[model samples]
Target chain A: MEISKGWNARKKKQLQVIIAFTIVPLFLLILFTYYPFLEMIRYSFYNMKYIGPRKFVGWRNYVQVFTRPDIIRTLLLSLYYMVGSVVQVALALYLATIFCFKVKGENLWKGFIFFPYLINGIAIGFIFKFFYTRGFVLDTVLQVIGFDLENLPYWLKDQKINNWSLVFTSIWRYMGSNMVLFLGAMMSVDDTLYEAASLDGANKWQTFRHIILPSIKTIVTLNIILSITGSLSAFEPPYVITSGANGTGTFFVVMNDIAHTSQKVGLASAMAVFLLFVIIVAKFVQDALFKYIFRNADTDDESADVARARKKAQKAAARKAKGGA
Target chain B: MAKTTAAKVRHHYSAGTIIWEIIKYASVILCSFIAILPIVSCVITAAKTPEEYQTTNVMTPPANWLNFSNYLEAFKTANMGTAFRNSLIILVFVLLGSIIIGTQLAYVLNRFKFPGNALIRNMFTFAALLPGIAMQVVVYEIMTNLHLVNTMYGYIIMMCGTDVMSIYIYIQYFENLPVSLDESAFMDGASYFRIFYSILLPLLKPAIVTNLILKGVGVYNEYYCANLYLQDKRALCTVATSLYTFTGPLGSQYNMICAGVIMSLLPALIVFIALQNQIYSGVAAGAVKG
Candidate 1:
């Protein structure tokens, strides 16, 4: 009887621990994440300010989001970033391929490149502001390399090239980390595959195409998707450096302006919702495209047995075709 | 046969391969140069006198490398001392709160198979998909209602509230830890809290390090929320927002602004140099798992 009572007490203590530990985190998750999301959706359907009365205005703000030319232009600015992200991914993949081989001072090269990823974003903004200033670092470097001072266009002042310049800054800041991620994935690839490729007289490019590319395709796809989604909400470079001037205002920056400066809470909420919808749609399309492209590759989530069977069947079919040929 | 193949491979390193090797090294060198060029310019500018800054090209060496008056002036004018203090305070509380909250929640979810276990996990997973910045409009409203605007503790709490990443990290770490440890501790008549505090928490050092590097850098360098919520520039300015004090009337002073920018970067630079390996591995591991 005494032992039974002791066991009951222990069970109660365990239950208490479970409840006590979980309650606060759950409350926080609900309050900060779900509650705010629901509130944002509700706010999207009403015309409101921060402090004043709110009136129900069904779908009007969302209609404004689709029809407003300035807002539409901001959304279109994502194209620059989308192109930049593609460039960033390509540069990162190229660097990763180089560094994965035996290179002198590999760590030093990587350290220099990856250092920017650790920099404060605001500081990078200020540094680049000085860099792109008239007769500053970029122009001076160009002059030393034999370009005339009169030939150099104003970097930040000219709308034609300013967005591209900002895009380059984003690429510079992000490319190194993406390279590191690619390096990690490549390093984790099975070594025996490389040995087999070399034994088969496969050259470097052939080995990269057959072994490295196929193995790290998942990470490559992931990086592309992440960068594309990230481009849709590009904020820091334009926000900090140009303050969204000279045709560089991204979707988030303009939404921030409307919300804070103009005090249009409802409109901002609608814009936010619209962006979320666009990102979700983009994610789905990318997932489908990747699935279609990588149809023959073994998926990461498949069981080893299933993958091996598939490989065996493929090999048998190949052998039969060779014999017939 | 292996030795012959190795010799043949060595013989295949011809002029074409040599040219390719040269190109590779040159490109790597060029990339590294570009990476540090902007910072190098800023460093040079920070050391120049106002007159020297105006006369010399940006790539030119400062006349006096020891001219640190610009740094002193920038520090004083930008009120950086207070900014650093506030930032440090916020980092301490937010990290502490996140660690405790994240670990406790992870422990409960991992060890117990209660009624709401799957539901809670799904909730967090769904929350990860939600665009956090998009919900900021309503979050700002909620913060205003809760009187959390313009307050440090409020910011700290809000930071702690959004630590879904760290919680996931802890849960992943917990999966590797043997439940036998808990069972053995329980067999010794120890309380559940005792088992958690004494045994399991010590084994979570790696996860803690990873979380620290990720969360510490984020909270330290966070600008947007710090600007919006901590509105009092004089009292609540963080290291991020403190540099903005140079953008108004003092914006044209490149030397002073460069000094301020260098000062802001110094802490992260020092930490990076000190813990480069840990930071790299931590970041890689976090990215892969996340």
Candidate 2:
């Protein structure tokens, strides 16, 4: 009877501990994330300000989000970023592949490139602002390379090239981190595979395609999805450097303007909700596309084939060397 | 005959391999140069006097490399001392809160087989899918309701509140920890709280470090929420927003602005250089798990 009572007490104590540990985090999650998300959806249907009467205006704000020319233009600006993300991924992959091999001062190179990712975003903005200023760093560098100062366009002032410039900045800031991620994934690829590839007389590109690519496919897919969605919501470069001037206002920047500057809380909420919907759709599409692409590339089957191929290649190479001898 | 064959094989691949190596080094060097070029420009400009800045090409070396005027001016004018103080306060509190909340929640979720455990896990997983930036509009409203707008404690709480990643990390870490540790402690007549605090928490050092580095960098550099919620710029300016002070009335002073940028970059640069390995591995591990 005493032992039963002790067991009951312990169970109660465990329950109390669980509640104590979980309650605050759960409350925070609900309050800050889930509750706000639901509120955002509700707010999307009403015409309101921060501190004023809210009237139910069914789907009007969302209609404006779709139809408004300025907002539409901002959405289109994502195309630049989408292109940039593709380039970013390619560059990062290339660097990662190269660095995975024996290289002198590998850590130094990685540190130099990855340092930008560690810098404060606002500081990067200010640095680039000075960089792209007329007759400043970029133009001066060009002049040293035999181009005239007069030939250089105002990098921030010119609408045509400014977005590209901003995209380049995004690429610069992000590419290294992506490279580091790819490198980390690549480093985990079995060492024997690379040795076998070399023994089979496979060159660098062939080895990369057959060995490294297959091994790191998951990370690659992840990086792509992240970059694409990130492009759709690109904010910092335009927000900080140009203040969304010269046709660089991204979707988030526009929504920020609406919510804060114009005090159109309802409209802004609608835009936010619309973006969230688009992101979800994008994520689903990417997942489906990846599934389609990788349908036949199951790990078990691939590894089996690779093992068999490696054995065959090793036997052939040994036979060829024996014949030559 | 075997020696000749081996030599021939080496000769066959050496030329191509050499060229490939050259290309690889060239690309790495070029990329490293490009990455540092802008910051290098900022550093160069930060050293120049106002007159020197206007006269000299940006790539030119400043007449006086030791010019401290711009640094002093930017620091004073931007009120960066206060900004750093606020940012440090925010970082300390947010990291502490996040670590505590994240670890405790992770412990509960991992060690217990309770009724709502799976539901709670699913809730967090689903929350991760929700685009956080998109929900800021309503989050702003909620903050206003809570009177958290423009207050440091409010910002700290809000920052701590959104730390889903840290919780995930802790949970992943906790999975590797043997539950036998808890069982053994319980067998020693240690209470549940005692087991958690004394035994399990000490074992969570790695997860704690990873969370600290990742969350520390994020909270330190977060600009959007800091700007929106901390509307009283003078009182609530962080290192991220303090630099924006240069963007307004002092916008044209590139030298001064560059100095401010360099100053802002310094602490992070120092930390990264010191903890490059930790930061890299932590980020890689976190990204893979997340």
Candidate 3:
């Protein structure tokens, strides 16, 4: 971890210039990022009094979180979101594969796919909410089909269905992005490989499997890990969908659910910490599995893909190392 | 044989290709419709008479209602004037501060090759590591202590701290530039700042613009932080905040909200379309593999 060896004192002193640039800024980052996290973990063990001394509640709060239906529901809703994210990213890979081929009118397809990703999730939530509730392409058709404006289903509204609606919006915004990633990965594939495969009478499916899929294996895995991690800890959209200010929603739906509404800052902090742990563990396991499956088969990947994949794997490993530390 | 095979494959487009192409084109068009639908619905709802909107489907209305007056009512009623003023100020400060400061930090990190350079660069990369919401409770605590809560400056400062993406872009671009440019200027006895100003700064022009477009549009579109931070109605809020009032209970005026959504997204959308080329390349450059 130390700098290159054999530098004199003056040389090392000069090295402070670089250290200062990163260390100083990093102090700010850690202050904002890690400190609160540590505080939240610490607070999770204390009683719920803002004024009282930090008393040890220990396993009591953790027990409450795991056993309580409402808290358990929060964890379940997150699982639903994870499902949506995985599916959406998978679809994106399919779309990205097509884009990689640079079929006719790629500009249009690329724009359409990434269009939702450009809009913030909250805005997309509001936009979709408006469309489903009051607006539509053919109101009369819906009416004839027995859909009533007076009793619109709450995608972000009802507890029973709010999660599904939020999942759709996530897919809408994220599908294109995954597509773009796949496209980028596909572009990195050498043209000569496809040419060779074609000479062997590989059809599009065979080409995709024998060529495109194998080429972008590392990227696909990276996308999967990111999607899983991001979705598990997802927030904001459902918060907007239900309008958390009015209150009927999931655990993450309300911002001040911890310090304010639930009056369980400790509980909320526990929830957040739990989410962080799940993400880290999921990513770690995902990286190992991906590396195992594709490592040998993909050694022949072009230098760029190899470098990119190694960087991704290294970062994932570093994160695991950090978690362990 | 390779050429013949390539030709043979090209000549024999299978049912899969045809089906795949159909699905791709159809979905592309279908998705475009879905993507553009909300904006259209919002606009229609805004322009059409309340009775027309309530009685009919939002997407279809008499052609006569495509008027701009819904915007006037919305602006006047929603306190949009104040929101616009607030957003404008936020944009100006955030754009100048985040980029200007981020670029400086990026320069030292990329060119200096110091001992802790990897850690510094990793700090920016790892900003995206934590769930942004997890950090919010604490940032809220800090901002509250700073007395920046609900203030325009509070919001701008919060945004200025959104340097992770901008810093990443700057580092990527700076890395692409040769180090000789900076060393030669330094050898001429110029100060670090002087070399940055006269040589590196000029060389970094393209990146600066790309960063501005990506970062500007991103900061403007962001709502989560502002929603969390802002409270006072009298305090300056952005156009984005103003648009939400339409969806509020009893204030759910579909027409006005739609018109307002259109107006709110216009600036960013126009910038996006104008620099679509640069944006594609700029964004490609900023692409994080994961």
Candidate 4:
């Protein structure tokens, strides 16, 4: 009877602890994340604002998202940022490989490069604004290199150079963190692979291609996909530095303006939903591509094994056909 | 690995290899210089007088590098004292709230075989993938209806609510810790709460540091929600928003703006210099495990 009573007490204690710990966090996630997401979907289907009654506007907001020329143009701007992300990742990979081998004052170089990632996004906006201003930092640096002021293009004014300038800032801010990530992955590669490759008289390029690439393939793919999504939501540099001026308005900037300035909450939500769709599609395509390319590398249960077996059967059939012919 | 690489280096010390080494060093230095050049110019510009600022080139050194009046004026005009104070309050509360919620949730999820375990884990992963900025439409409405706009605690609560990363870090940390410790404690007469508070929490120091660095920097630099929720600029301006006072319609007062920017960057720079290794390792570990 006493043991039964003790068991009951322990069970009650377990129940209380579990409930107390889980309740608040779950509530917060639902309120902030899940519920808002659901409401965003609902709001996109209605003509509404922060104040006033909602009216059902079936598919109108979504239709406007694709039909509006300005919105379509803003979506195209994501391409520029996407290109920048690719270059940034490549540069990060190069630098990570170099740092992994050997270098003097490696920590100092890493610190200098990575320091910008720690700076507040707003501060970077201000710094770049000053840097790009005519007769400012960029012009000064160019002048020191013997370039004439008459021949210099304006950094942030001309539409041609303005977007490129913004893209460079993104690279500067993000390249360091990406480098550190790649470095971590590279270091985690088995050292014996390098030893064996060296014993076989492999060159630097050969070693990198055969061993390093395969080892860090997962992280490389993950970063590429993340950069695509990140580019889709590009807001900070344009929002803070130029306020989306000079044909630099990205998709997110357009959404922010529509929602906040124009008070077109439904339309803005529709734009957001469209961007989310773009990201999801991009991620899906990337996964499918990775699976196709790295067929045996994937750990999926049935599909991957089936793919391998199918490939083997096809090869056998090809051999039989050759022999018969 | 080192010996093999060294042996290869000795054997391959040809003219081509030497040229490649020089190119590598040069490119790394150029990259580093590009990364830091603008901030260096900001420092130079911040020290110049108004007369000198207009007359001299941007990279020109000021006569007095020690002149600190611009920083003082920026602090006074932007009312950065109040901003810093408010930011401190928010930081303390948000950090405490996140650590408590994150650790307890991770502990429960890690220790117990609950019914909704897989569901909750999947929920968090899915939520992280969802573009958080996309949900601002309805979140603004929720905050308004709850009368949370323009209040400190409201902003704090909102900041604490979106902290999925810290919970992820803690969960990752908890998985590595042996479950036998908790099982043994339960076998003893100790209660679940006692076991968590006395035994498990202490072992999580490294995770706490990692979370603190990540979350602290994020909250410190966060301006979007802070700008929206803390609408009363006079009372609740954060370090980020405080810098915007110089960037209004009357044109940017960049002399003062540079000073304020430097001020805002100082704390982070100091902490980074002191804890560079910890920050580097923590960032690396977080990325890998995550």
Residue A241 in model 1: shift from native, Å? 0.8
Alpha-carbon RMSD, candidate 4 = 5.5
Off by over 4 Å in 1: A1-11, A191-201, A286-297, A300-325, B1-12
Candidate closest to the true structure, highest TM-score: 2
C-alpha positional error of residue B126 in candidate 2 after TM-score superposition, expressed in Å: 2.7
Candidate 3 stretches with Cα past 4 Å from truth are A1-24, A49-56, A101-105, A134-160, A190-202, A244-251, A254-256, A297-325, B1-20, B113-115, B121-127, B162-166, B205-210, B282-289
lDDT of all the models against the reference? Answer: 0.84, 0.85, 0.67, 0.83
TM-score for chain A of every candidate model? 0.87, 0.90, 0.79, 0.86
Which candidate wins on lDDT? 2
DockQ each: 0.51, 0.51, 0.36, 0.55
Candidate 2: which docking quality band? medium
Worst 10 residues of 3 chain A by lDDT: A1-10
> Per-residue lDDT for B9 in model 4?
76
Q: Candidate 2, after superposition: displacement of residue A71 in Å? A: 1.4
Candidate 2 docks with a DockQ of: 0.51
Worst 10 residues of 3 chain B by lDDT: B1-10
The fraction of correct interface contacts reproduced by each prediction comes to: 0.58, 0.66, 0.28, 0.57
> Candidate 2, residues A1-325: lDDT per residue as tens digits?
9999988898898899999998998898999898988888888999999787999999999999999998999989999999999999999999998887777798899999998988788988888888898888888888888999887889988998999999999999989988888888887766766666566665676668666787688888877887888888898899888989878999988888888889898898898888878878987898798789778774424565675576566557655765797
| Tens-digit lDDT string for candidate 4 (A213-277) | 75577778878878878888999889988899888888888889899888889998888788778
Candidate 3 per-residue C-alpha lDDT over A1-325 given as tens digits, one digit per residue, 9 for 90 to 100:
1444523543554455445444445555666776777787787776664445667788676777678776676666677777887888777777766655535676765776676666655456557767656336434336766888566554444566656766777787767766766666666666765565555445556557655776667766777777767765666666666554322344565424665565666766666666667777876798689779876765434586674565445445545654686
